[model samples]
Target: MSWTVHVGTILHLLDPTANPRQCLDRLWEEVEKWTSIDGIWLQCLPGHLQPSGTVLVGRCPDNADEIANLASPATASLNTDGLPVVARQLRDGNVPVALILVSHHHQPQPAGFLVDALSRYLLDRLRLQLEASELAEENHYLRSSLTPQVMQHDILTVSGLMETVIRSAIRTAPSNATVLITGETGTGKELLARLVHSHSTRSHKPLVTVNAGALAAPLLESELFGHVKGAYTGADQDRKGLFEVADGGTIFLDEVGELSLEGQVRLLRVLQERTITRVGDHRCIPVDVRVIAATHRDLSREVAQGRFRQDLYFRLNVVSLTVPPLRQRTEDIPLLINHFLQKCNRENYKQVEDVPRKVLEILQAYPWPGNVRELENCVQKVVVLASGNTFHEDLIPPTIRSYINEPHPLEHMSLGSSHSQDSSIPQNPLDNLRQALEHYASNAGPNIGECFHHIERLLITHALNKERGVKLRAAKLLGINRVTLDRKLVEFDLDVKRGIGVIEPLVDASES
Candidate 1:
């Protein structure tokens, strides 16, 4: 069938080049010359609305309104003056664009095939052009900017500690030496590994990651070194392992400490010889792959205790990088909270604005056991359950609330009486604190830190109360800066109003 392909509205993409208006004028000029048509219809909506497939693009020879009416939902297929009009929707990056082909003969399937092929090529060209434009803009911005920017990745960190880590990772990424990432679980070890892979010369190749702790000994071995057909009971067909799959790329071995003794020997041999022998196979097949192993366990300790092999440990420890736990770098919490909140909000379709100051204090106070992973989960939980834009202290997990609810150590300081007011007590404040802790410890709660935090809150409140709500005076009395005193006031929810320091208890709503 003889057919003429017509371009419909291009969705999502706007002309990014300089002088878009002139470009559009020139585009129409070329279209008229190519199609031998005078003009076509063009519509640019103000907001992000899906383009109707029947909307005319450029200029239509027939009346645009009449054509739209003829191509309405009721008129699926049509014949206009012995010409068959077929329209199909094509998606470019989830944005749909309509492609119409008018054929002199009635051959719907072939016309559709031709339209789809043409649309695919158009979409591919558009994507390539868009990417090129973006890259050029990015290069220009980076060259003009003074600050060094991290490569585009999901990692969000403003902490100096993380900046150093990122710099180190970038520096070492090009090398082929095995990298050993040591950190507590959820500290973004795998993310760093992937970052290294992305920056490496072999970035164009595959990256296969396997969790050494997740599988049994035999399965882990088979997964790492492949298996021949009839090698085991379930081996119906020969299978390539992760090493083979990751050839010319990087293979990340997470929780490498969990590997059994035999598995360690096999891994060490592979690292040394750059080859692997399939299960039940004598032949040693050469494979080229970089190894990036990670674990929370201390490999040196494991080796000393005979749980892990010394040679294998040495092989993987060529370039060791330690990721610090979240508690040590609490300064990054605000940035992290903002990042994860935006993420969870988008994913959960919520509109959480920010974490309230009181809630931030609680999150900052609690020692994150699961590190960044736990913090992310906590943010997700709060966002999913948030009733409004602001996240309050009450939304925090009960364990945290309970931990912050200790007796303030300086509770008696507000009484304005010396410890000797009772003859049984020592005059020293430290003595008073010790006695208070002993009494509180008798109740058997989580830890001493929780009790100590209570004392800290009490001391700050007493200082504020003594100063009659003047932050400057309170900071001087507490021997701290105004910034620290302000933080303490927020942490303890100590509202200083009307010459009084009122402590707001972080009580669970259910209990209240």
Candidate 2:
């Protein structure tokens, strides 16, 4: 087979997410499988300005010879003496990332093209592994730094009502009493649950969250009290419920108001007895767990109407905490906007440091019917499209822009601009891809591989832009998860390195 075909086959054979040592081993194995050759050796250069002495031996089997350091990278690339080896050094944005050395005992083998192809493949995978490690560390640091003070300062609130709620949460977190949190849909009832779990004695254990409202009666029973094999048609194996999984931990049952009468009886039995029986089994399993429930509805009123059982209501409402909606506390709007701005900046890799005064006024005036969640969406919109350190009137969504009397930018720019008259949102994904392709083809010539990679990068960019840099929404648009999208952004240097709509290849696809 031609070496180019081997290159493509190599990608399919190797795991892209493997670490340097693992990837190198897989590469060596694949190469050995496809070619009859003696053992091989590989080297990976240090990245992110790390030391040259720290350059890694990508893979050196216990029996393989150590001959990678015989010469410098430049000399190593051209060297052919001693072991009669083929070597290649590959770089990313000018920093050497890997060196490949494929050799055999005095025989002319699949030597030259294979070494170069392997070097390119190994380089990209190594960078991904290293970046993944670094990102993991960074994320852990960010998470660990979310102390109680920071959580309260950043997200809880500046309102006296919120302060009262937070104070109650703090005082009640250390106890085992059941907590019933009430609030509007987007007012962060889940956050309150987390705060309680983090401070309780069970903090080290799991916090299993269940949306009780989403499940039907039978499914809810089976989910809360797991089933044995053949409990139902779909019961293929024995399973554990969220409560059992959360043994010695806390279970946060969200939207408890929606649980049916039968589900309520099962839950009440668990709360009263601290035991659960599998759906098919009569044997009872004991558990030690704390319960935290949240609902947007008033459970008391439901009980008064006989829609909810008073006994279950009294069992769950031992302690109550309510979160006020954004409209009730307009003073917190600016603080929340800034808070979301910082968060989205880190996520989308933007540097928006300021919110314009007039824009803030318009945002504050809006009713924010969706509560803090909607306000956050609005902030994310402005931040992603800001293009600078401050916000502008044009960046605001039309829904929010409708609050004021000033002429919309679309109306003024309608004379010449091609943006939609109704909204600034981009067209459908297919249109975005077509326009991106046309733009890419107009600016530079790309091979099939490069063309495909460019299209992927553009779609990710367009999806992020369309969703206002909300990674989850953008991922939904691209049919990928947020983690996958993050990896793609880093892989292609699309995060901040290439600004929105810029079509430049950081590395050739064959090499990437």
Which candidate number would show the highest TM-score if scored against the true structure?
1
lDDT of 1 by residue, 1-512 (tens): 12234443423223446253333333333332333322234434344433222222222333222122223322244333343344333223333323333332212133344445445544554555554455455435433442335324546665555667777887899999899999999999999999889999989999899999887886876898899999999899999989999999999999999988978888899999999999879999999999999999999999999999998999999998888777545655666777687789999999875454546656665557799999998888889889976665777778767755543333335333432232222122334555656755654377677667766765665455443344544565566666987888777656664223333432321233
Question: Model 2: runs farther than 4 Å from truth?
Answer: 1-154, 404-512
In the order shown, the candidates' Cα RMSDs to the true structure are 20.1, 21.6
**lDDT on C-alpha atoms for all candidate structures:** 0.63, 0.64
What would the per-residue lDDT of candidate 2 be over residues 189-277, giving only the tens digit for each residue? 99889988988899999999999999898698788889999999989999998889999999999999999988888899999999999
TM-score of 1: 0.53
Candidate 1, residue 40: the lDDT equals: 30
Question: After best superposition, candidate 1 residue 291: deviation in angstroms?
Answer: 0.5
Residue pairs of candidate 2 with colliding backbone atoms: none
Off by over 4 Å in 1: 1-153, 407-512
Q: What TM-score, computed on C-alpha atoms, does each candidate reach?
A: 0.53, 0.50
Predicted candidate 1, C-alpha RMSD = 20.1
